[model samples]
Target chain A: MNKTVLQIIRFVVLVLFQVLVINHIRLGGYVHPYIYMLFIMLLPFNTPKWQLLVLGFALGLTVDLFTGTPGLHAGATTLMAFCRPSIIQLISGNQKFENIPEPNLGQLDGMWFFRYVLCLVFVHHFALFFLESFSFRLIGQVLLRILLSVPVSVFLIMMILYIFKRERKRE
Target chain B: MYNLQRFILKHHFVILFILLEVISILLLARSQNFHRNSLVNTSNVVVGKIYEWSSDVGNYFRLNTANEQLAEENAMLRQQLSIVYDTASCVYDVNEGDTLYEYIPAKVVNNSTNQANNYIIINKGARDGIERDMSVISTDGIVGVVTDVSRHYASIMSLLHSKSVVGVRFKNNQEIASVKWQTNNYRYGIVEDIPTHIVLQQGDTILTSSHSKIFPEDLMVGTVEEFYPTAVDALNKAKIRYATDFSTLRHVYVIKDLHKAETDSLKAKFQ
Candidate 1:
């Protein structure tokens, strides 16, 4: 499939899944995993800086509209996108991206991919929860929420990516 | 001029990032103000319609629970009706003459309890006589207040939200306090401003106080789960278990105070 068309389909599917399914899963009221961050994470390596930021903002705004939070998700996701390129460079030190088309489990070493996902997911979740609380007064609760939610979100995103990669290999 | 253009072209990414962040911050600021009509809430027709469709499917899975709640409310209403009929005819006539509150039934199209700032979208909206600032309550207890309304839908600030507060009083002694959700727990809220003289007890019922302009007096709020004296303030604080199970909330009533305008105008004179 064409890469652009594939990414578009992934965008719609992930957004629908996040809003309709994941948003309803409130385990202990603390583990609200935002799996839609996968859409931003999985974008092509060569995607333009401008496109990355715009797409990130649009994706988050779509969720905010559905969830009735006007700008909380938008701000966090945009910040994640802004930091993506730098985080990628910082994680893949001394490694060249000449042969790699994008960051994925198949193309990157398992440890490297895990570290990358963890870093970006942490940034997203940290920004999201802190922005949602928007207060230093509730810093303890906010930190606890970030600590609990990030791992769940990272795990779910990686699981979905692994399943899709396997299906593509079989095809 | 060429040097300036080159600088702009070289650092466009940073400029764009800052621009988008600024827009997001503006939106965040706008939404934080309680009275402002935000541009990107679920009360918008498109978003509300989507949630309405999804909740339609979700409703089937919880039908049994919803039915039980309705049945329980019916029994309670019937009990109230019998008492009303048993009263003196003169007193009944006087009660009929003054109807201070009106209720508009609405279905929950979308709801969330886990977010720090949670909101509920309902099916009824401006067309159904739902307006901003009207109080919402479930069959069991108070829910929230309407904050935004479109033609076909309205968005409510749920009691689970960090900023949501309700004026409440103890049912046993009528001593007033305010309930606020300071923690992530949906079933519990923190009660503040309790008078130092009032004795505390677990399982005490809390009801909406007459001091509130939005909610009616004596509506069920919750029950005392625990109490403690805060180190900083002389007032005692307590934890209360909300009467309404927000996780399964489906149907609700939007209360319209008939004399709200009169009350506001009268209160404005003092200000």
Candidate 2:
């Protein structure tokens, strides 16, 4: 499949899954995992920075439309996309991505991919929760939500990636 | 001039990032104000249609609970029918032939309680006689007030939202107070401005007071769970478990007050 077509398919599937399935999963109201960030995380390594930010904004806006929060997600996801290149550099250290097309379990070692996902997910969730609250008055609750939701979101994203990884391996 | 142009060209991505962030923040700020009809929201026709479709699937699984709730409300309304009441002749000043409020039934197309500023979208909108600032209530208790409406859907500012406040009073004594959700907990809210003189019980019922223009007086709000006097104001604040389980809310009524315009105009005179 063409790369753009594949990404588009992934985008639609992930957004629908996030809205219809993940948004309905409320574990004590604290574990609202935003696995939609996976779309931005899985973009190809050589994708342009401007495209990343725009796509991030679009994805978040789509979610906001469904959730009735106009720009909370958009703001957070845009910030995450802006920080993506720096986070990747900070995590990968001297490792080059000349051959690696995307950051996935298939291309990267488990530990490195885990660390990459953890850092980016943290950035996304932290921004998202804080922006959603938009006040320090409920800082404690917001912080708790971030702490509880990040691991769950990461786990869900990793499970999804693992499924993809197994399919590719079988092929 | 050339150097400036070069700087702009090199840092275009950074500039774009800043611009997008500013737009996002502006939108966030605008949405925080409940009165504004934001350009992007669940009440948008396309978005509401998508949620309506999804809720159609989701509602099938919740039909048992939804039916039970409707049955309960039906039983209660049955007891209030004129046929069930006894007629007595007395010198009573009765005002006849006036309908004070009208209710438009709506289905909860989408609702969220996990967010700090939660909102609910109902299937009824302008086309169905729904309007902004109308009170929304479930069979069990008060739900929210309509904040935005499109042609086919209306968005409600849920009582669980941080900015949502309701004027409520003790059902026993009519002592007025206001309920506000200070935390993310949807099951409970904080009651403010209770008179320190009134003795409160553990399970006192709180009902909406007449002070509110949107909500009709004496509507069930919640029950008092715990209370304490504030050190600064010497006024009592209490925690009340909300009567409406926002998490399970599916059906609601959008109430239209027939005399709201007159009441609003009268109240606006004092201001």
Candidate 3:
């Protein structure tokens, strides 16, 4: 599939998975996995920062629609996308990440890509949990939820990236 | 001028990011009205049906636990109901033919307890004897008042909420005070406006006063847990630990008295 096709497929898969699948994966009737950030993580390295942010907003808004939380997810995801480039640069130091297809753990290596994904994921989740916790009393709960959810989200996203990479190598 | 235009173009990504974030913030601040299309909302009929199906599946798995709860509740209700109404008075469950006919049951369509203007939705509405200002109470105690009624649903203010205000009184001496939830305590309330002269001893039972036409007289509110004299006002206050568990409240009843409006108007005229 071409670039547009792949992006569209990613969008559809993420939305369906979030609404139909991940929602059912209830841990203790609370904790839910958000694999929707795959869109931000897989953006092409040199894609205009504008496109990345828009994609993030769209992804977040779509999830919010399903979950009945209007801007919570959208703001967090957009923030993640906005900071992705800087985070990627930090991890891939001296590696000019212009062309070589965005976020092929093969191109950036495992540890760097993991850290890159981890930083952006933490940023997205922290913003989200903090905003949702408007009362300011539940700081411990908010931090704990963020800490627990981020690693799970990142692990799922990395597994997806790995599968895609292995498929690319076979091709 | 060309460089300035180039700057705008070059840093346009930052501008776009700012714009999107601003929109997101605005939307976040005002989320209650953002469901314009209603297509993706849980309130939508299609989405409601989908969730209903899933909840049904979950309900199946929860049956054993539900049965255990029901059995325990049944014995408790039986004992209590027997005391309230002896075997000679009546004895029948909610699902029974005769008892079911007396009360209109409604499914909770949508609900939120975390807002200033919190409301609970029941599937029954105007056509189903629900109207504005109707008294809504669970088997436990007062839940709230019906505020809005649609063709198929009605919304009620939850008593657990900070916004709920109901007429309350001291069960023993009949000291009237309006009960408003402070949100700090889930199962307690600050009953205000009791005169300082009237002694408030701890463990004093409070009940629904005749101050409001919504709650009938003598319905239990709670017992006084603590008392303090607020310096700002002449009246004393009591912290009432409520009898009912407001959080686990799932089902409620909307009262429709045979002489409701007539009795209210007559009492209003006297007042």
**What are the per-model DockQ values?**
0.76, 0.72, 0.32
Estimate, for each residue in B200-267, the C-alpha lDDT of model 3 and write its tens digit: 88998877876776776676677788899777889887788876665444456787655676777997
lDDT per residue for candidate 1 within A9-104, as digits (tens), equals 988899889988898887997788998988888887999998999999999998888887777899999999999999999998889988777777
Which model is ahead, 2 or 3, in terms of DockQ? 2
Q: How does candidate 2 score on lDDT?
A: 0.86
Per-prediction TM-score, chain B alone? 0.94, 0.92, 0.66
Could you give candidate 2's per-residue lDDT for residues A96-161 as a string of tens digits? 999878877876899988888898899989999888888787788889999999999889989999
- By DockQ, highest first, what's the ranking? 1, 2, 3
Runs of candidate 3 with Cα error greater than 4 angstroms are A1-35, A98-100, A104-107, A133-171, B1-9, B32-43, B67-271
- Which candidate wins on TM-score? 1
lDDT of 2 by residue, B72-92 (tens): 889879877544343422433
Q: Which ten contiguous residues of candidate 2 chain A have the minimum total lDDT?
A: A162-171
lDDT: worst 10-residue window of model 3 chain A: A23-32
Screening candidate 2 with a backbone cut-off below 3 angstroms (N, C-alpha, C), the clashing residue pairs are none
Candidate 2 TM-score over all chains jointly: 0.94
Q: For residue B225, what is the lDDT in candidate 3? A: 88
> Among the candidates, what TM-score does chain A have in each?
0.95, 0.96, 0.91
Which is the better candidate, 1 or 2, if ranked by lDDT? 1
